[model samples]
Target: MPDLASLVTVPALLASVFFFIAGSVGLVRMPDTLTRIHALTKADNIALGLLVVALLPQVGSIADAAKIVAVWIVVQISSGAAAQLMGEVALAERDAASSGPDQRGMAGGRDA
Candidate 1:
């Protein structure tokens, strides 16, 4: 029979792969930038977490496991920040596109 680590690691890795594929699909299939970012970030974060969990049981030492977890944490922070920035830019562009030119105001104001 297979060991406990194999049982845990195999399923977790499979789930991680599933989520990563979901994120990729979302990135391509979503209608808009905001929705795409939403899907990708959410799916990818879960995938990364599962990947870390899968690897933890396989690592040789506590330090190796800790490093894996730390990498996940760092990626979580960076990806969140990047998604936020991209969302802001997308929203700004969307708002600008929706607004009328008159609302933008004249560059020189009322000329005599």
Candidate 2:
């Protein structure tokens, strides 16, 4: 018979895998960079996070759990920052492209 730990770990791992698959599907199907970021960050992060938490029992140490949590937090912050930057850059480029040639240069009597 499987031990309690194994049973728990198996289900948690399965859940994590499902989350990852869902995230991947979202990434493929979602339109726009912003939506993709949402899919990748939230879905994948949650999946990986659950996996880490599930493994905590196996780790058998408070220090390991703390380290995992710290890593998760860092991932959350960095992914959010990256997504924000990507969105900003995409918007800026879109704005610039739609704006056509620089009117400021034309007004200043400089070559565009």
The most accurate candidate by lDDT is 1
Judge candidate 2 at residue 15 and give its lDDT.
Answer: 92
Candidate 2 stretches with Cα past 4 Å from truth are: 97-112
Candidate 1 overall lDDT versus native: 0.89
- Between which residue pairs do clashes occur in model 1? none
Collision pairs in model 2? none
Residues 64-93, model 1: lDDT tens digits: 988998899899999999999999998887
Error of 1 at 27 (Å): 0.2
After aligning candidate 1 to the native by TM-score, how far in Å is the CA of 13 from where it should be?
0.4
**How well is each residue in 16-43 modelled by candidate 2, as lDDT tens digits?**
9999999999999997677787898889
Candidate 2 differs from the real structure by a C-alpha RMSD in angstroms, to one decimal, of 5.8
